[model samples]
Structures are given as structure tokens and as C-alpha cells.
Target: MDRAFRWAFIGTGTLAKKVAREITASERHVIATAYSRNREKLCAYCEPYNAYPAISIEDAIDRSDVDAVYINVTNESHYEVCRQALELGKHVLLEKPFTMNASDTEKLQNLAKSRGLYLAEAMWTWFADVPLQVRAFVQSGKLGRIREVYMSYCAYSIGYAPRVSDPLLGGGALLDIGIYPITYAYRLFGFPLSITCNGDIKNGIDYGEHIVLGYDGFDVKMDVSIVDTKGEAMIIEGENGFLANPGYHYGESAVAKTKSGVDIFKGQRSYLKEFDSVADEIRQGKTESSFIPPQATLDCMRILDECRRQMNLVYPFE
Candidate 1:
């Protein structure tokens, strides 16, 4: 087997720990170094994986052994951290909500392109087999002419996760959780012709939103909330029948119901696939991910930007 892929982790938060567990367990990946604002936390996070604790972001990425950086920093810090990694010539795998907005996302993409370094959004849904099968089923004419799509990613993160309600950290329901359903629609149907959004905003943070992505012949309706728990099922309606993807963002399976019969597509729900795929792409000297292409990320960010515009929701820094 080839040498394990080396990674420098830039954040040791809850999400970072989860990823660390998955990535380190695989033979194809290992954490070379880690950095966090809290030194104690960083040390503790690195101890479990036997990874080095770096003093700073630059220290972590500037190492000769570190081939890529997995950035799970706060939503507000994505662009700068990713930019810094790319500038240092390390490939980057950034967590979701890409960069707070499309402009920053595009900048990072262009920077990666110019530097000849690998860059990807780390939107795991796009790499999952179920969603890919669902997209293929939709395009195979088995679903017939698409009529409408409905998706919801509502969860009560505001009360439990303080960062979800903090505007200074680029917090809000739209950026925190809405991207799942929006990206789902975009992956299946491409860019929309128009977008209409309505939401509740308080204390400079959004609580929830209802978005309609208008396509050529149909509209995808999506609802996202951070203060309440609604269902998170993605339903695709077509002339033949309908398909339902539960927990669409991170789900492992999707079921399609049609007049002929029912079809089920299932896949693994592991971060290992995500890390391994990215490592393979980088090893092959690719500058962009085929799974979550740069255009798709930019288009989704543009959609999020539009939603924020309609609702007049802006982060404190922006």
C-alpha cells in the first residue's frame, strides 16, 4: 500500500474531533499536526491520535511532512485559514458554508488554481453514493418529468449551540444548516433561475428561512431552522412517482417510489470516504474535486447570498 496521507488539522472543536477519529482510523490517512486557539484543547485533541500540536496555523501548514490541511474552524475564519493554507502550498479541505459568501469562495478557488494545490468544500453529501444514485435516477427519465422538490433541514441548534446564534462568528440558520438542502437542490437540478426567501431574524441572527429555488419547469422549496425541529426529509416529485431521502444531508440511503416498483440506494455514512477521496485526488495532482466542483460551491454560495439578501441578514463582520 502507498504511504498514509498526512494532514494538519486547523481546528480542534467538536466537529474537528469527530473528523479526527474517522480519518485517523483509516490506513490511508493520518493527522501530522493540529492547531487550535486553546493550547490545552489542541494538546488534548492531538494526544488521542498521537499527532503533533502546532503553535499556530502557519506552524501547522508550513511543515514539510504535512501534505494537506483539514480546516474545521469557525464559519467566519474559513476564507483566511483556507487562503493561508493554499498560499503555503498545502492542499485544503474546508468544512461547509464554504467561506461565508460566494466572493470569498471564488477567491479561494482561483488561488488554489493558480497555486496548483487541491481545494474542495468538504460537502460530504456530494461524495455519498445515495445522493449520486438519486441524481442518476432523476436524470434517467425513470422519475419522468420533475414536478417539484421539497427539502427541510430544520434543527434546534440555537439553544444548544451558542455559535449558531452568534452573528460575529457568521452564525445563522441559513449558513449553519440551510446549505444542505440548497446544495441538494443545486446538485440535482443545477443553478436556479430565481430564488425567493422569507425568514425570521432577531438579534442580527436568523432563526429560520423558507426558500424557493425556481428552475425551468419546477421549483424546489426548502425550509431551514436553527431554533426549532421540523422534519429533514427531501422529497422529489415527478410525473411517475416520488423519491424520499431522509436526513438528506448526511443520510446513507435514498428510496425511490414509482409505478413500476420501489428502488433503494444505500451507502456508508463515514468520513473515511470523504478523506480518502480527497487524498486520492491530491495524489493525482488535481487542483479541484470532481465530487464537489468549484462551480457547484460558488453557485450554492450565491444562492445563500441571495437568501440573506432577501431577508436582509448580514453577519457583523460583513
Candidate 2:
């Protein structure tokens, strides 16, 4: 906390640009280096923040100034890039879906553990307060034994995200927008007893999916899409009442209804919270995050692997 947290960014795409804007806005963080396949785009991304645009992935992480690496590269490159950073003795905060499969996720996790390097999946929902508050409300018995739950994170991302339909890039609705709802379910109910998935696959990639996570007493049904727009909504229904959020993944607030009355829970929604929290943890000499723990990430990846297996959604690179 005494010095600014320096970050080496491995990708300069849309997500990386947005995160850079937030990180540069604060004095506690700095984009010490950045890399991209496109040299022109990389330079453009680094100018506003006055960051050093590295020529390669190794150039970005090899610098002594960088305390951690923030990776938002193509999904297929997640494991290799994270492994490179950890091998270089730099902390890593990777974008989700952690890896293409659980096996690779576990490998990277074990590598970090063995080297005593900090590593985490940047699943921002848990860092937000609303979902945690909702979890607390449900656990408090205010929801009176949850009976059913449904979440939808469908959007027409095909036109904008060509990568969503590109199998070579590890593209699919399950890895794109699907991760939010899946991680949300895992965080609330832990691992499911049974996992079932029905998906629409076109041109070697998944366009959408209907996933059901079966628990002991109830079922959590989730719908995710890249070619269709079903609207983003989340609801946790219990014997007493239900909790609803219009934009569940990134929304700042939610409403809980019961026999007695209605209550609203609010929280901060900025992406910077995730980065700052990780930086602070690393600064404190912690190798793991309390918000997005290693076990939670591995569990979510296992669920994703099972869903992919059922849907037969395989990328060419995988």
C-alpha cells in the first residue's frame, strides 16, 4: 500500500482498454506495460495512460517494475499467458472463464501455489456487494428455504464479437456471457449434484445454451446466448418470497420480497474494485483472494467443463 501497484497488461482489447481507463484514473495503480498482437492498437492503448507498450508477452512481464500481470487475451491463450507470468515470478489476475477447461485451470493454480505467486480469476460479481448481500439474505433464512432459481444473460453479441463464433479463439456463449450466471450459481449454491445443458451450435461454436444445475432440493435454470437477446435477469425464489435483479451480473442493486415487506440491497459496481482489491492483497503478501478464492474458481470451471461436455462444444484449439 505504500507504493503504487504496477500492472503489466497482456491484452489491449475492449476489456483491457476499459480497465486501463479505470486503473490510470487512480493513483494507487499504474499500467507499467502493455502488449497486443497489433502494434498500432497497442501504441494507441498505451498513450493515454503513458504506459510502456511492450513488444511481446515476455517483454511485458519480465520488467522488474511490474508487480502483477493483468491478462485479458483470447480465451485459448489464458493458460499459457498466465503460466508465463507465474513462471516469471509475477502475480496474475486473469479474466474469466479461467481457462478452456478445468485441467488447465488446476495446472495454473498449482503452479502459482508451488511458486508462491498470487493468482486469481477476475470474476467481478463476487467483488461487488449486492450478490454477497443477497447470499447473506438467503442464508439468514429470510428467504425460508430456497425452492427455485432462474438467471438469464442472453445478448446478441455475434455482430460485434466475431470471436464468439470462432472456434479457433475458444469462442462460445458458455465462456462469454454464460460464465457470469454460472459463477453466480456456484457462489450461491456451491457445486451442483447434477449438471445438464442443451445448446445451439452453429459453424463449430455454441450460440446459446439452456443450463440446469440440480441441487438437493431445487434447480437453478440459466439461459445464455450470443446470437439472441432474451434480456438479462436473475431471480432466486424461495418458499417465503424471491429476490430479483434486472442486470444480475453487473447490476449495483437488487430487490428482495417477502411476506413481511420488500427490501433493497445496493453496492459499488465499478470494475476498479476488482483490480484494487487484488493489488492490495498482493501487497499484503497474500497469494489468494478472499473474494474470488481458488476453490470457487476451480469449482466453476469444473461446472463449465461438464456443460461443454454435454453440449459437445469443442473449440479447434482445445
Best by TM-score: 1
**Model 2 worst lDDT window (10 residues):** 157-166
- lDDT agreement of model 2 with the native: 0.90
Instruction: Kindly state the number of residue pairs that clash in model 1.
Output: 0
Q: In candidate 2, what are the lDDT values of residues 1-318, reduced to their tens digit?
A: 468889999999988978888777888889999998899999999898889989999999999899999999989889999999999999999999899999999999999999999999999888878888987887788888889999999888876765677888888899988889999998888999999999999989888999999998999999999877888999999889999998779956999999878989999887888888998899889999999899999999999999989998888765
For model 1, residues 1-318, the per-residue Cα lDDT tens digits are 879999999988888888878877776788999999899888999897889999999999999999899999999999999999999988999999999999999999999999888899989988888888888889888888889989998887897666788899888999988999998899888999999999999999999999999998999998899877886889999999999998788856889999889999998887888899999998998888999999999999999999999999988797
TM-score of each: 0.98, 0.98
